[model samples]
Target: MSERETWATRAGFILAAVGSAVGLGNIWQFPFKTAEFGGATFLVVYLVAVFGIGLPAMLAEFVVGRKSNLNTIGAFERIGYRNWRFVGVLGLLTGFWILSYYSVVGGWVLRYVGGSLTGAYFGDAQGYFGAISAGPEAIALHAVFMALVVGIVAFGIQDGIEKATKLMVPSILAILVALAVWAFTLPGATPGYAYFLSPDLSQLRLTVDTTPSFPWLTFGGPLAAIIPFAVSQAFFSLSLGMGAMITYASYIDGDESLFGDSATIVVFNTAIGILAGLVVIPLLFAQGVEPGSGGAGALFISVASAFADIPFGRVVGVVFFLVVLVAALSSAISLLEVVVSYAIDNYPVSRPQVAVGLGSAIFTLGLPSAWDTAWLTWFDTLAYQLLLPASVLGILVFVGWVFGRPGVEELLRGTGFGDGVGSLWLWLVRTVVFLGVVLTLALGLLTLFGGADPAIVPPL
Candidate 1:
């Protein structure tokens, strides 16, 4: 095999990781989910979950990747845990499964970028979104988006993924900072900030009646009702549980501080998510559109409609959607990398060939979702409810139980941290992180099979 590729710089690696985490998950999903689940109430739960559960889980993937310096599957086998290679296999599958629908969403962002410049969706944002969200147009755009991803990955790591993300991540942050400043001056900005940042603890503990029409109705508490979605949102927002991190970390050239880098990536990702909410939520409020009014298309429909009446609306819309497009492409690159890295690591195929071939196949798999919005919704549910949580749980188990001390040592290298910290991290992964994921996965299954409240489960 040819020599493995590595990141051009430490900053390049950090930006690439942040780019992976700071995509549609932050821009498209965060505001809508915050709106749907009582605004700041959801925000609080999401923060707790991100730090408490998401961070440790991310550390586990970092350990595996940098230690073995290989793709997810080969990382396991390289470490002499051949049987546990299934964990990496699951991650590869999760990344592939996710990008199928993720590409569909990326296509949506691309369409919105065009529509913003032409004011195509200004008059009837909802109608326009409904019209273009599925069918031939969506499929065509999805293929376009996948082609962009394939083109980038075909250029190899240093020239393609790293360089692209260096530009994209910084551009995204700069645009969002400007947009958030402008959004603060909107008439309803106060209420929007209050809704997004001010916590209402009662909403966090809210309950629901499963069946109001019959005696079979069962009531569920906040813990059972809300934790799964919040946890899944954390996983989704940080790009955890998919081995995207593992694939990216494999490119690191030296012994960097994994803990420090993990924390930096987490901070950047979470900040982008909050900045997105600041921009979108206030804009929705400014238009007098109630939160959650637009359903699954909340970010697209609600924000686009709000732009119709604002000053310089067309220009603002163009800039905003351009930010979304950049974020989407950055994330799509990471997801495709996971699959492309696996193919080149294990087979005789070249990077360009694997990128194009796998990109085409993934696009074919996503056609169902592109053909119908209902299929998109189904894919979203399956990801949050099963694929993400399951992949995360498996990785934690491997690092904590299967890989054992060697994995902990990998994590602590170059951090100047003692064995005590490693032991604590391992303990958290084994117990808190592990059990928390188990509970999240179990609750997701219950929500799927036991008919949990639709309000608690994210319909998106």
Candidate 2:
């Protein structure tokens, strides 16, 4: 209607965006990937992708959403030529697909919050986690979790999404930092550090080869497979490419320099994830927990088991779960904002109608996920491998080709940094930057499916 919606305040906007960036992926995905792939090498490749690839692509999406002031669908149609609507539609559907299970996992975080607070999981948390990982309990919790999301969206952007995030993000960050400091002193932490912080090129070579025991994917060698995984994790950890960032950017009101904002978000998101690594990995090593178990319960099982053994470990467990709970909800809210904004902008529907209708639809789709770990893994892998990269591809096409250099330059005009290089930057975005993502995606797909080899490096 009237240039869509804007964030209530700048602080809310940053927090909401940060909330999306910092989530369970930061806690679970980053650490596990690092553990399995070789700590510093994986971290190194991941950092490269984050700044080299993710930063450019994120700025591209910001240009599209902020300039047009629209959700994924509207942003695409307004910017691109014919048939781009299909791409736009795909992005919107990806958002829905992500929310379905993201909220479900958010519910698990809620469950763990109770588990931590009650000291329920402190004794046999491995068994405790196994029992509640899926089925009706998870579904019911998901529904309750979705309702909370609805309440926030119902209040609209400024008052609802922004306000809650402003309080939640800082609190989440603070607690997580404190927990990491405490965990640094865990007894078995030396071996854990040896496993987590030490660089092992031999180990990296093995994982890159996709050894049978460490078979997350197949490639010519651990190095070959790792490039794609690192690239994907970099994007995944940042919550980039999904309409979450694009839609969040759509609400911006000023020339606050998209690169600076996006960079700030990326730095914090990566730090929180590294902090998670510091806390969880060393503890796993300390407890004699196997780094080889890169399954669904990376943090929930091994790390949780470690929590049971420490002095006042139960207290630590509660605080850690609270960190997860806050991070999950904050991300869930950012995702829900995308869908709600879609309906509000495109239809005559009220925000409440949009939230309830779409939220229910997505929640139904997530049933199979809650029923089966097999399905949940498939969904998570699909989102990480397919939807996320595709979303980045969409932005590459949108800003690099559709809107062109002049349009992008105009968006960055009022910024404080280099003002004259807009044309040069736009040219780079259209050609080099866009092509790099394409090559990464194409090479990644080939290396993933085509390059099957057997190897396993020793643990980091």
Candidate 3:
């Protein structure tokens, strides 16, 4: 049997991890979510969730993967907990589920990148998006995106994943910073900043306005509704609740500051998300756009439309979609890696074979989502609302109870932190992070079942 591969450098691992974390969630979803949940108030709640919930959960996953020094499923098997292996399985499945539709969305970004350069969608953004969103074009683009992802994964870790991220992550950040600076210079950009940075207490209060409809709106105040969204975003944005991080961690070659690396990923990811809002919100407000309806089309329609109206709109559009393309590709690589790692770890097959075979299967599974909007919506809700939270809860149970003292020792292996910090982290994962995810799950269920007001549901 061939030996397992490891990351060529600690920096490679960190860049790869950060690349995974900063994805479409940062570039596409964060700004729209902020606009929907009352701007500044949502930002505050999101920050709290990132530190309070996201950080600990991420570190916990790192502990398991690094300790076991194996793929997600292999990690649990090596730990000698047969039952707990299910968590890894769940994560692996979630990664597959997410990547299926995720590739479809990545395809949208790719299509727009081309459209931007050729001025294809310049005049009618909405019409163009609607036309391409769920059709043969969408499917073809999705295949192209998946092919790119497979090509990367087929190259193996250091040469493929690490090197790609090292180039992609820095470029993503630089583009975002430059766009944000330009956005702020636009006339009437202050309103966007105000809406994004100033808290509204009324928005924070849960108040439902009922209607005799299946998808009702139960506004559970900002604290009840918005916080859950923030928590989920933090999880999704950091690529938690999936085996992506675990699989990436399996490539680590030596002991290092897992805690510090986790923290850095969170910081860089959050900064990019905020900077995205800075660019998007101000640009929209300056152009007298409201990011209307906050659908999947929000970024494509409103932001793209704004670009159409601006000087050098074509140039801006190209840069913007290029950023999204990079972000999507980086994240898609990680999601694909989780599945590739599993196949390689368990089966006697070459990485290239697994990459192509599983990549094709995922693309086939994602066809319904590409062909129909409703299927896409349900798949997204299923993964994010149900599977993701449940997966994280399972991890918490395994780490907090199954691994117990050994888990803490694993976490403290490289970091100089004493047992006290480890104990506190464990407690936080068991109590705060666990409860926060539970709340998110409950809220998601409520929204999914039409118990909550549809009005309060974040834009699709």
Candidate 4:
């Protein structure tokens, strides 16, 4: 067997990881959820969830990968817990499941990029989306998007994924910052900032009096419904729970402060997410488009419609969709890497062959989503609602339970921290983080089956 590839530099790994975290989840879904869950209200909860729940969970995966220095499943066996390999399997499956429909959405972003160039969607944004959201056009775009992912991963880590992300992540941040500056100059900027930055705790109070699937939500009211939503959103946004982090961390070389690296990745990811809101919310408010009015189609419809009326709308649309396209590719690369890492680790096949074979299969799976929006919804519901949270829950359990002392030791390596911090993280993983993930999964399930409005659930 050949030696495993590692990131050529710490910056490469950080950029790659941040690139994965800051994707369509930030640019597309974050804005929709902001509008759906009440602007700053959701923002406050999301921030808490990110630092509180997401950070520790991310560290747990970091410990697994850095210590084992292997693929997700192989990490378990390398760590002397072969029986716990199933946890990694679950994580791999979750990543694969997510990237299937995720590629379809990436294709949509690709289409919008072209549409923006020609001012195609500006005339009838909603109608254009409805016509092209699914069918042969979507399928072709999906194939194109997946092929880009395959080509990158096939070239190995440092040469392809690392080099590409180093360029893309910086571009994403710079462009978003410029867009946010432009957005703040709009006449309606005050109301938009007020909506996004000003906290209205009352908006979190869900007035739903009855939840047949999970009655506790009906009683706990705001805390019950919103907390879970925020938790899942943070998890998805940070790209945790799907072995992408684990796979990325596996490429680390030296004992370079995993905690610090994780913190940096989280900070960059959150910054981009907020930057996206700054640009999107203000643009939507300026055009008098009702935020969240278009449901999952909000980015294509509401945002596109806003672009239609703005001065130099065509240029702005091109830049914005270009940002989304870059973000989508960054994320899609990581998701595909998770499975590719697994295949090259366990099988005799070469990286390029495995990439092509697996990419084709994933593309085939996404064809259903490309064929119909309803199938896309089901794919999103299954991956985010069920697979993701469950995968995170399992990995946390393994870190806190099965992998115990060694995991903590691995965590303490680069930080120069004493055992106390490691122990505390272990305790949180064993208890608080563990319970938080369990609650996240349970709430996700309830939201899935409880006849809750599908709009409130995180789409893609």
Candidate 1: where are CA atoms >4 Å away?
A: 206-219
Please name the candidate that would achieve the greatest lDDT relative to the true structure.
1
lDDT of 4 by residue, 1-460 (tens): 4579999999999999999999998998888787777888889989988988899999999999988889998999998899989999998888888899999999999999999989999889989998889999999999999999999999999999999999999999999999999998888767888888998877565444554535455434555566666787788889998899999999999999988999999999999999999998888889887766876778999889988888999999999999999999999999999999988888888999999999999999899999998898888767767887889998888889888998899999978999999999999999988887787776677677766555556543
Would you list the rank order by lDDT, best first? 1, 4, 3, 2
* Predictions in order: lDDT: 0.89, 0.74, 0.87, 0.87
TM-score of 1: 0.96
Model 1: worst 10 consecutive residues (lDDT sum): 210-219
Give the per-residue lDDT of model 3 (tens digit) for 1-460.
Answer: 2468999999899989999999998987788888877788889888988999889999889988998878898899888887788999999899899899999999999999989999889889989888888989989999999999999999999889989999999999999999999998999999999999888866666555576544344446657768667877887899998898888988888889999899899999999999999999889899888743546668988888888888999999999999999999999999999988888888899999999999999999899989986778778767767788888888888898778889899899889999999999989888888888877777777777856656655445
TM-score, candidate 3, is 0.95
Q: Write the per-residue lDDT of candidate 1 for residues 1-460, one digit (tens) a residue.
A: 5578999899999999999999999998888888887888888889989999999999999999998999999999998888889999889898899899999999998999899889999899989999888999999999999999999989989999999999999999999999999999988778888999998786566354666533344436665666788899899888888889999998888989999999999999999999999999999888999987766777788899989989999999999999999999999899999989988888888899999999999999999999998888888888888999999999998999888899889998889899999999999999998888987887787677766666665553
TM-scores of all candidate predictions against the true structure: 0.96, 0.90, 0.95, 0.96
Off by over 4 Å in 2: 1-3, 80-82, 201-219, 292-294, 427-436, 443-460
Worst window of 10 by summed lDDT in candidate 4: 211-220
Cα error, candidate 4, residue 258 (Å): 0.7
Writing each residue's lDDT as its tens digit, candidate 2 over 1-460 gives: 4346688666677778888888877876788888877777788778878887877777776777786678877876665554676665666777678778877777777888788667787777767776777888988888888888888877787888888888888888788789788878877688777766666666455323345532344345456656666777777667776678878988988777776688788888888888888888887887887774746576777877777777887788888878887788787777777778878887877887888887888889888877776677767767765677777787677677677864667557567556555666677677776665664565455533444332221111
Better of 2 and 4 by lDDT: 4
Clashing pairs in 4: none
Q: How much lDDT does candidate 1 score? A: 0.89
What's the CA error at residue 252 for candidate 3, in Å? 0.9
Which wins on lDDT, candidate 2 or candidate 3? 3
